[model samples]
Target: MAREGARPAYDPAGHDTALRATLQELRTGRWMSMRRLLTETTAWWQWTRRTQVLATAAAGTDVVRTWLEEEPHSVPATVMHARVCVERALRAHREGHPHTLDLWHEAWRASHTATRAAPPDPVPWVCLMALARLDRERQWAEHRVAPPGPMLPPGPWGLLAEADKRDPYNREAHHRMLQFLYEHGTSGRLAEAAGYAHWAADTAPPGSALHLLPLYVRVERYRRSGGRDAALDLHWVAEDATREAQRALYAWFEQTFTAERSLLDLNHVAHALWGALQFTDATRLFEALGPYWTPQPWAYRTPDQGDTAQAVEIFLQARARCRPA
Candidate 1:
C-alpha cells in the first residue's frame, strides 16, 4: 500500500526495511528469527517498528492462521497471530466497527494461547496488557464507565509484571504500563506521569532507550493540552522540565548512538527540542533522523490537523529552523 503524502526530502521509506524483513520471517514461521527480531527491536526501543510490523501482519491474518494451524507449537506464529488479532481489534474499535468486541475477544483468546505456548516470551504478555488497556479505553468511551479511579484494574498490571519478569528492561512493556497509568490515573495529574518517566529513566541502565520516557510524557502533555502552539509556548525552553528532558535526550545521544538507534526515539526528541526552541539540539537529532519522519509528535502538533501534509510541514519547518547559520 502506498503511504500518503509527499516523502520527506531525506531518507524516506521510513527506514522500515528491517521491519519488513522481520515480518517476512514471521510469515514463514521462523521462530528463531521472530525471537531475535523481537529481542533486537525491543532492546533498541523500536516500538514503532515492532508495532508497524505486527499491524501489517495482522492485515493478513488468514495466512497467519494457516501457519499456526500447521505448526501449533510455533512460538513465532502464535505470538504473531495474537499480535495481529489484538491490533485488528484495536483498529476496529478506533474505526467504530460493529464487530469490535468479537475481534477483541478473539484477540484475548489468541493472546492466552500464545502465552501458554511460549512460557518464557514477553511478547504475549505485552499483547495481553495492550488488549486490557484498549478494552478499558473502549469501555470508558462507549459505555460511559466512570473515569478510571485510584486503582487500575489488576489484569493489566499482572500482565505487565509477567512481561517485566521475562524482560526486565523491555521498553515496549514499560511503555504499555506507562500508557495504562497515564490513561487510568487521576485526571490532570501530569506530575504523576512525569514521576513515572523519571523513575523509569533512572532505573534503566545508562544508554538504555528508557531515557526517552520523559519525552513521551511531554508529548502526551502537549497532546492533552490540545496540541496548539500556545500549549508548546506555555512550557518554556528554560523551564526545569525542558532542561531535564534535554538531559535525557543528551544521555541517549551520548551512550546509545549506534547504527541501530531507533528512528522513533530520534523523531520524538527532535520534536520536543524544537518545541522548546532548542534548535541546535533539535537540528542534530533531525540530521540523525535524515528525513525518516514517523508521523507522530508532528502529526499531533496541531489538534484535529493530522494529515500527512501537516506532518511534512512540521518536519520541514523544524529542519529549517535548525539549519546552521
Candidate 2:
C-alpha cells in the first residue's frame, strides 16, 4: 500500500529542483537522517515521509549501489529512499519473478552517468544470475543488430534447441520443454530432450530431486520414441541413479519419488511405475493425480483441527493456480 503523501499546496516553480536537492541531501554521502531532511522541507513533510519509508526498505549496499547507478531520475529524498525500492525488488525476485533482476539492474545503471565499471568479483548468486541473463540478452540483440550478415558465435547453451536447455531455478520450464517434445514425438526433439536431461543431470547436485523429473522426462521420451526396451533402460538408470539404492526398488515411484508418476495413484501398480508415465498415460493418470495433488475432499482427515484445514486450503489454492489452462 502506498503511504499518503501531500501534494504541493502552491504552484512553486522550483518544486522539481527542490525535490531533487532534497533527495541528494538524504543520500549516502550526505548522511543526513530522514527526520533531519524533512525538517528543511517542512512544507513537503508527507513527501519526505514517503521517501523515508521507501529508502529504509531499500537499505542493502548492493541495493543502494543499484539505486545510485540505475535510477538516476528517481525522485528519492536521499540514497536511502532509492535503497527501499531496491529492497522491494529483491524480495519480489526471491519469491518468484526472476524478471525483477532486470528492473534493478536497469535502475542501478540509470543513477550514474559515468561509464560503468565491471561489478566487483565474488558477486552474489542473484547478481551473477542477473549478469548472465544480461549477457544472454546482449547476445540475442547482436544477432538482430546486423540483419542477416555473419551470425554471432553462440553462447555455451544458446546453440542448444529450446527443448535441450534448462534454467536451474525454473523447474516448470524444464518440465514444459520436455512435455512438448514428448507430445510431439519429434526425433530431433527427443535427442534435444536427452541433451537437456543430461545437462540438467550433470549440473544438479548428486541425488538432487531436480534430476528425477528430467530423468523421467528422458524415460518417457525414450519409451515414446523407441519401445519397452527404452522404458526398461530408463528404469534401470533410475534404480542406479538414486543415492538410496535399497529404497529405490520400492519407493512409491510416482507420488513419493522425484518423478512421481501421480500424486494419487489408483492402484499399487500405478504407484510402482510412478516415474514411467508419458503424455498419453499422464492424462489417464490425472484422475488419480488430482485427488492427491489437488485439495480434494477425501484427503482431509480433519476439517478444522490444528489449523490443518487452513493449510490444506492454501495448498489447494496453489494447486488450482498450477492447473492446466
Question: In model 2, what is the error at residue 258, expressed in angstroms?
Answer: 12
Candidates in order, TM-scores: namely: 0.79, 0.25
Q: Candidate 2 residues 1-325, lDDT tens each?
A: 0011211121111223444454455455443343454435432222423343335433543444454455454333233433354445545555767777675665344322111221211112112222232332444442113211122222222212221222232333334334433433335545645555555544544433334444354335443444335334455336443322223223223324322232222222222233332323323333333334322221222234335455355443333332331
Model 1, residue 65: what's the lDDT? 71
Per-residue lDDT tens digits for candidate 1, residues 1-325, read 1122335643322566766676676566554454566546544235434654655654554666765677777666777788889888878877989999899899989989988997877888887777766655445332223323342332255566787788776777778767766765555856666776777787788777788898888778777777666636666465865775587576777777545466667788887788777887777787677647677778777546558677778777777867651
Error of 2 at 25 (Å): 47
Residue 181, candidate 1: how far off, in angstroms? 2.7
- Candidate 2 Cα misplacement greater than 4 A, ranges: 1-168, 177-189, 206-208, 222-325
Evaluated with TM-score, which candidate comes out highest?
1
| Candidate 2 minimal-lDDT segment of 10 residues | 1-10
- CA lDDT scores, all candidates in order: 0.68, 0.35
